[model samples]
Target chain A: MELENSGRESVLQIALLGGVYNNYLALEATLQDASQRGCDEIYCLGDLGAFGPYPDRVFPLLDQYNVTCVQGNYDDSIGNGLDNCQCGYTDPRDNHFAQLSFDYTLANTSSGNRAYLRQLPKEIRLERYGLEILLCHGSPRRINEFLWESATSTQFLEYLGKQHQADIIVGTHTGIKWLRQLADQRWFCNSGVVGRPENDGATNVWYTILDIQTGHHGSSKRRALENVSWRHVPIHYDYRRLACEMEQEAIPTEFIETIRSGWWTTCLEVLPGKERRRGRF
Target chain B: MTTPKVSLTHLDQLWFQVAGTLCNLTCHHCFISCSPKNDSFGFLSLDQVRKHLDDSLIAGVKEYYFTGGEPFLNAEFVDILCLTLEYGPATVLTNGTVLKEEWVERLRKAESLSQYGLEFRVSIDGFSPESNDPIRGNGTFGRAMDGVLRLVDAGFLPIITAARTWPMEQDAEILDRFVQMLRDSGYAQPRLKILPTLQMGAEEQRTHGYLDSERLTDEMLTDFDFSQLVCDHSRIVTDRGVHVCPILIESPDSRLGETLSAACDDFPLSHGACMTCYQFGAICSNPSGQAYRVKSDEHGT
Candidate 1:
């Protein structure tokens, strides 16, 4: 990711893709959509491989599109040749599936890809449209932090921003997209992943488009929250092809079901009640 | 001769002993020996809870947890939880014996309104009545299961928390039976959290107290992750005052101070309960608890 700080008055639209999880099909669709939408820059909040087929396929596309990236828990683990994904799942069943996914992604990820992931920054702070946006995976504080929409408190997000000295923080590791604004100025956003469906029982996946538009009339340094318009852009992708390739690669059918049906068949324990209630389990 | 004391790294979770020692059903394995008559500890009113909630603002409490002999035994339990939802995500640990329909309905609405999750961790000792009733009490399983059904029907996925008093090897079989039972009983997605049984109070007589060697030593802290210990990131507010943890509420030494900030002092892990916590990682916290780990070393993100 670019460390350069560029300030501008013009509308800055950036696409944030979170946790590809090796779904190259969705990655392709998301990139094309972002391009057609005239996204100024596309950033991927790490975890490049997991759940889907051919972990290496998504790398070339990411390179072709010039997507700036942040290191996720999976990327850190795979890059360092760690034993586990370090998602900190406690449930026996959740651990069982996490291990399988980790092993597959790590084993299949190319050594060069691992090297590329290892060099990626943990956080990317870029000043755009007078707003300092900090892009990270999981959270600014911890790599594997699961900031679920329901489980995370606004005050806590505020603490992360205050502690980290960022006006706006964008993170994704929970696989769900949510944004909470403080005084309509500072914000915390989870760029929904393109890895798989959001466990919302829909075939379509999602990525986020942060549309930082016209700031409120003020001599104050901070921009108004109303100026920061963001949306979870739903992307309809070739999920069937992804699932077929996943089956061909002998990926877990449980994961394949999540891609096809959009309900998470695994990693349900980590979800809080509100998030879990939204899914079919 | 020195007892290992764990530092309060951060105020991640704040527990309110809402109902105190008052409970409708006296489980054989209750750590506090809470019964209908056990008024040794007392209820914390909504007013008292609000005060602590105010105090928690300064502490930056990430989550709010409600527990007791049975939290619903308190008259203002639902109101307390509703108020807590405004601040952060709230979780209530219930015996699954006394959760009323009106309360669940109200809580469901409160949860939907709040951005945070309202988690209900229901205590069900066993998968079957025969196994569960002997420990929890006769006919207690039916009532708890009823409560579970009520929560499920209300679109709340309550995590069925069971005590692993049996051998570790049997956990898989027992959990499988639990999932199968919940599925058979119309709960399609059953969330289960297995807890290590604390050998203290009623359980001490029912089973046995911890051995002298079970205590944590400073040497043990060499490379141990302090975040795994609830005392490192949590404090429970009882009517008496703020206690170090839910498990050692009965122990006088567990009382840190009157306020959450005053209770920031490191706790001496002198009791047997701390051993159980040391063996298990953050058992008191919800499953989502593992997400907030202490940042890794120099390679930290």
Candidate 2:
């Protein structure tokens, strides 16, 4: 019956990748959207915690929805066993602040949650709605792969070639929602980071719904992904409340300040200072 | 009122990944997360590199560069460098951990043979092993120094590139420490290039990546210094194709086109790192020493 429903309806397949830490309101809204849209399945790509005020609130919701999530570097960092977040990025300075984010996240996550995070796979390959899709936190080659729209087509093709099977490679971690097709082989899309803005300075987080269909475009049996739409779903949450919680959790002052500043220190390109609100501060 | 004409030019620099995605030591913060097991980007054959060099020569390219998991890891690195020097002044960017005495001698000999200069840029994250080893790998500092010393012995003054993971205020002390280390290693005038880490790749996990706000829109380039941007003039030739700039090789859009001629179009100002390049002109080139220099006490102090 479920299989029949998928065929009859242009069932939109949706997967939630990492960077969606603890914005329960956003998560709930997405889940609600999924339920309303007659979406077949919803998957959570890890990172489930960090930077947000609530890890406890976010994890159970994921389970409740049966969202398939893989452990991101932050998820591991929050698990308490790993010496570092193992985010794959390194600081020559061996920064105290970077390590602090890991500490606070670990202190907040529960044992049961840690076990669940520990069990998540690095990459997942799925044939959803008859389309070959590769779902990963970063790239298929490595976990925490930062595949941005700014990357070269050749670089995308290289990863696409490595897949040998995927027609579409979807990733998270770049906080920016991007969708692009590379020749006939594959389409690389990032679900964008739910923890922050979508790099466009918009406060809305990103999520995608792909309506897959079996069609013959040329002289071939091709499963085409149609109506691939992404929305920067905006949810107004009490950020001050989240910031205060982060501060109370003894997360680094910088980490807390990041929540306040709404600026990621690494990229150094994005994040406009909210001069409009400066006088209020 | 008239808008200034924005003209795109031929790619002046051609960067090639000689040894592909396989590096000798896996740096914890490698932007591409390149390692021994990672062969997603394969080493370019000498013939392949020569083909790109031929393309560059025809296109009148101004510079050439070789980068890799570790460029020296390519067995034909010397041959590739020799081939590159024939066309233009070449720079081989390496972590400087695996420089062999024989390889250094060959490089010097090749430089002498060509009218164009051959430069070696070493990747040195920190001045000390304690600081560098934890991030690069254990015993990497000592090995890197050996490589640097060998280049010095061979009469090739290598430019040491250190990614500034430290605060901006602390740059003077860091540069001083770095210069002192280089002097102690016996290079009379130590050339250093301080780089800011692009928070992508393996480094993304080591730290948070670019924020949602950290991206470049097309209009931002209007007031921005696009001339200094590597993508403005340089193109990288990988095993598969030519890329816009060396920094954005991992990006699918980084590939400008297959050849230098094909890449000679106005590239859209994309990537958050392009903002960094725009903020500071010509992050890849400099007038004093090479393309870029570290914050020196002479300037910063």
Best model per TM-score = 1
What tens digits encode model 2's per-residue C-alpha lDDT throughout B99-208? Answer: 77777888788777764566777888999999888889899889888888888777766778887778878887897799888888777645667777778788889887
Instruction: Tell me the TM-score of chain B in each candidate.
Output: 0.97, 0.89
Tell me which residue pairs clash in candidate 1.
A184-A225
Q: Estimate each model's TM-score.
A: 0.94, 0.49
lDDT at position B134, candidate 2: 86
Where's the lowest-lDDT run of ten residues in candidate 2 chain B? B292-301
- How close to the true structure is residue A105 of candidate 1, measured as C-alpha lDDT? 88
The TM-score of candidate 1 is: 0.94
Off by over 4 Å in 1: A1-9, A214-219, A224-226, B292-301
Candidate 2 lDDT over A101-140, as tens digits, reads 5566677778998887777776677765456777777555
lDDT of each: 0.86, 0.63
Please write out the lDDT profile of model 1 over residues A1-31, one tens digit for every residue: 1121234345578899998999999999999
Any runs in candidate 2 off by more than 4 Å, and if so which? A1-9, A23-25, A92-94, A158-164, A213-236, A266-281, B1-50, B53-160, B163-301
Interface alpha-carbon RMSD, every candidate: 2.4, 17.4
Compute DockQ for each candidate against the true complex.
0.55, 0.01
Report residue A117 deviation for candidate 1 (angstroms): 2.3
